[model samples]
Target chain A: MRKKILIVDDVDINRDLLRAILEEDYTVVEADNGKKALEIIYSMKEELAAVLLDLIMPEMDGFQVLEELNRRREIIGRVPVLIISGEASVEVENKCLELGISDFIGKPFNNMVVKKRVRNVVNFFDSKNLLEEKVAEQTAILREANITLKAQAEQLKKRNQEIIDLLGTVVEYRNLESGEHIQRVKGYTKILAECFMREYPEYSLTQDKINIIVSASALHDIGKITIPDSILQKPGKLTKDEYEYMKSHTTKGCELLDAIKSEWDEEYKKVSYEIIRHHHERYDGRGYPDGLSGEAIPIPAQLVSVADVYDALVNERCYKDAYSPDEAFKMITEGQCGVFSPKLMECFRKVRGDFEGLAAR
Target chain B: MNLKECYASIGADYESVFLRMGSDSVICKFLFRYFDRNEYNGLEKAICEKRWKDAFIYAHNMKGFALNMSLTRLAGASSVLCEALRNGQPEDGVSGMLADVKSAYVITEKAVGNLERE
Candidate 1:
């Protein structure tokens, strides 16, 4: 199909001469002045391949048409405009080129030069527009792929946490412990962690860290799953040999964690290992397994230990009856269960009412 | 006179216009159509009325046509008249330049009329 070209000139002779030269290879369209030329340019914009604009005309002129094209930028870079003029000075030619014409063809224009300039400009713009469209298409596709990847990452993260909670629940059921024990420990852990966070900004107890600590708190007695049911569910007091075996549950849980170190994120694994192994450790260097003393016990374990001690006291077990909420709070504050860090004791006391509220629930 | 002789009589470049316009028959066709244009008359009227801008525009059109047709004398005279009437102010020599343009335009018109359209 022949590409359409617009010829804008005031003189019928000039327009005819160009049409005669160009009409053989192109579907030539003409306007005697700039006004009619502009109307045709706008109305036939999509169909036009190039414009052969004369610089001088009535009602509007080449420069005026270029000005309008500049204001509507979407059209300017599209259809190429070739200035056909007898403009004498370098100043006028430079001005036209600066105004965004593809090329300037001085009159008495040779047919070969006219045809070549028009064809080259049309082909150049065709390739440029095609490249732009391809880039835009690829950008949208990349954006869609990125969104899919992000959603997959979020789903994987949620499923990982669900499996961790499932493992903690399995341990709870196997030990003959109530399901609410793990949940209450988690609730109490959050309350105390948040209070500790506000009172001690030096610890950097951010909400994310608190969430990890709370989640890990559920797995504090996960080591108990390693103990035989005969010992775990004993109604009488544990003997010296059975108590020593029971204490190994903390180190035994760390062994289980070491096996899956590559599978879990470093932060979650680190906090879980701390809570599982050191929840039984005492701040006063008296409580066993590791005998970690003072601030030497990990903060995550300290927070969970206080929560575990409070939950264990308030809930009935095979060997012990449930303590009253008031008695449980008083016992923990009075160091009846285990000695904790002074700062941990302070945060624990601040949220004493919160602990009782969860125990009751 | 033949087309070549007609072009020669007006001091226009016959070979350049032939090369530019593509053929003698095409040239003859546009040459005759010149008589139908109003640029020269418009330039005359605008200059007589002292409408310098309109006169400049018309003179510019005249020079453009002369260049496209390879009409040397007309392009030279009209270009001078256009410069004289530029800046929307008529120079002292504009009337003289307009006479020169008129003489060149008349000669080209007479010369082009000598050639048959066929």
Candidate 2:
């Protein structure tokens, strides 16, 4: 259907003239006074394409109608208005334009200029409306995609946790140590690492890193799988050659880790590798497969080393009887089991009660 | 008299009006409709009653209606009267300006009559 056009003039002939010009291309609607024009404008707001308003009418003039339209922003913005008036003074034109009429046509109306201007205003508004609709649509689609991505990231984290637990089970079965050992070690590591983060801001450790450190501690003994059963489970001290073989477990554990093409996070695998290979490192280059000394050892490896030694001392191992928590704390603090970073020893001092608390559980 | 002579007699721009209207038939149709409403009488009544705002509106509408019909001489006369009554306060020489609009209206109406008879 042809778009509707409203011609408003109190004089019958003025409305008739515009109708004659526009009626061929549009569905012409006429209102002889301003009040009647507004009634038509409001009623046909959606269907009316343009309103040709006259400035002088009995009840409400064109300016009054324009002011009303201005208040109804949704209606005015969508529909174009072209003022047809003999009052072509700049002041009148400026006032109407400020009120948001799209264009002004002065009398005598040029048949072509009127047609061209009305068509121009109508086309411009249509394009603006279309662009706004497209932007709204795209925003909604992006919102949906963001929600889906958040849910996927949560699921991936959960799946990675399950895999870490499964690997710890394999180590428990092979090494024949109490499965509780790794769990307690994880608890102690997390407690000490949190305290370390507070007292040693130089490390810049976050809670996210602490979580990875504790979980990676579970696989610190994974290389015990490669040690001969007689050696790993011996109930007495080993000879010098056997001790050398036992030390190889750290490097072997990393080899086992490197053998598989894992699909989990690279950061997770990197933390696990550090824990497996260097948890035996000493502050004086006296411990471990690589003998990485001082702060040269990764912070993750240093943290798990303290957890591993404390858990071993308090838990009965194949080669030693369980010591009391106080005895284990003294051995670690006094450098009896291994030499650790002094900075770490300070954190361990603060978490002494925390470690004993987990041991009791 | 033919339509062109009739329009010329009133000192209106008949050729451009015909060209702008795009069709002689359309112009003639509006020409007859022009007499359908006479705001000049309303303007005169408003002045006599001292309804200044009403008088100004009547003159403003008269100017627009005359211009739309290509009666520039009438539109110009009415425009002068419109400005005098614009603020709705009585001004000096407004009656003389009103007289000028009346003469233009007379000539315009006479031309319409002649065209109707032709």
Candidate 3:
């Protein structure tokens, strides 16, 4: 598109000549007086690319226009200005130059010289404009890339949250509980598991290991799905056969996970297989499903076993009214010393408030 | 003439021009004129006789010439022939290669040659 060039000259003859010279290559707009020029300059500031100003005018002179242009520094500095005058005094030329006029055209100028100077100035302006356009294009491309990157990051965050939510949902679906019981149990188990691993670094509770523990904790009772709903949702006591059937859920969970071992990578198989198999195994020899004892079952599964039992005891279930937090704490603490490690119990006590809050929710 | 000798006369930069032609029409025309009518047919006969090594070298040089002239599809066909001959699969890619060479000849000899003479 052709750039708009404003002509500000009081003389009709001069404005006509300049317009004739520039109009074919440029879109020309005229203002006969400096006051009118300022009005045009301000009103069409966004559209005008350059200006040609005549120095001597009647009311508001070129000097006054230059003064007004300078006063609006931000608006005038960006627009290119060319000064045209019959006056050849050094003083006047110096003043125009000091006010940052782009170029000067002397009066009685040769038509060829006038055309050449204008063409050269316009060519320079064209090149400068091209460079600015390229920069703006690059900036827009960079902004688009940044926006895409931000959107992808948000998508990844939501995806991670959704996976966590899904894992919690799986546990809820198996037990027929509403809300995220698995999420709370998994979180609490993670805190206690890390503390237990720290107290005994022989187990190698590295950050990656901790993450796997937290992830695998959600599957601790996944075997419960295999138990019949009659036994699973039973309010009261279970017969020996029903109790034995219920106990087999842990082993069944492990076997089910084992069947899909070929499809998953080795790490996932190891963690999930261990969690479903050993979560119910007691620290002492007395626990059901497996006779495995202390420091034997995966620490994560053990931690989750403690947290799950605590949550179950403290929360109101269909069979029994909820126990007080104090009563539940007393049961876990006073019963079997070897059932849960002392260090883990300490961490559990520290975050007891969080568990209580989760239960309330 | 030794093609390498012609290149040496004009410095290393001269070789880049030939390198650019591959088996393209410009070099194809240059070679056609160089050997006259008997030459290209003679090379083709050698390939038919199962003189594998000679056919391989001819196809390799033709491949280079085709690419340099910006006749990309022609170069691609020649490239396949060159690879087949190099890998002792000359019979595998030969029919397709010969078809391409004939089409490129028609385009360059009729279209571009007519345009140039005008």
Using lDDT as the measure, which candidate wins?
2
Q: Residue B114, candidate 1: how far off, in angstroms?
A: 1.9
For model 2, the stretches where C-alpha displacement exceeds 4 angstroms are A8-12, A30-77, A131-139, A172-180, A192-210, A225-235, A259-262, A294-296, A310-361, B47-54, B84-99
Interface RMSD of each: 1.5, 1.5, 31.8
Per-residue alpha-carbon lDDT of candidate 2 for residues B7-59, written as tens digits (9 for 90 to 100) = 88888888888777887667777776666566578888998898999999888
Residue-wise C-alpha lDDT for candidate 3, range A1-361, written one tens digit per residue: 7878899876554576567567777799999889999999999887777888877665687889999899988655667788876545687788898998878875534445555677777667667767877998999999999999999866764554454445546667666554466766776777677666667687777877777667767777777777878998899988999999988978987776666523344564577677777777777756767778777766766787787788778778877888887788778876542376666677677767776776676
Output the better candidate (1/2) by lDDT: 2
Q: What is the per-residue lDDT of model 1 for residues A132-214, given as tens digits with 9 covering 90 to 100?
A: 88998999999999999999877866765775787687787685457788888899899999999999999898998898888
DockQ for all models: 0.67, 0.67, 0.00
C-alpha displacement of A306 in model 3, angstroms?
A: 6.9
Tens-digit lDDT track of model 2 for A271-357? 999999999998889898888899899999999899989998998887889999999999999999879999999999999999999
In candidate 3 chain B, what residue range of length 10 has the lowest lDDT sum?
B109-118
Give the per-residue lDDT of model 3 (tens digit) for B1-118.
Answer: 2344333432322344444333233443453442233223534765788876666655544444333333445456656665676655565658667667556544433333332210
> What is the TM-score of candidate 3?
0.44
lDDT of 3 at A149: 100
After superposing candidate 3, which stretches have Cα over 4 Å from the reference?
A1-4, A11-29, A42-49, A55-58, A61-79, A85-101, A104-114, A130-167, A176-180, A183-220, A223-309, A312-324, A327-351, A357-361, B1-118
RMSD to truth, every model? 4.8, 4.0, 29.6
Error of 3 at A342 (Å): 9.8
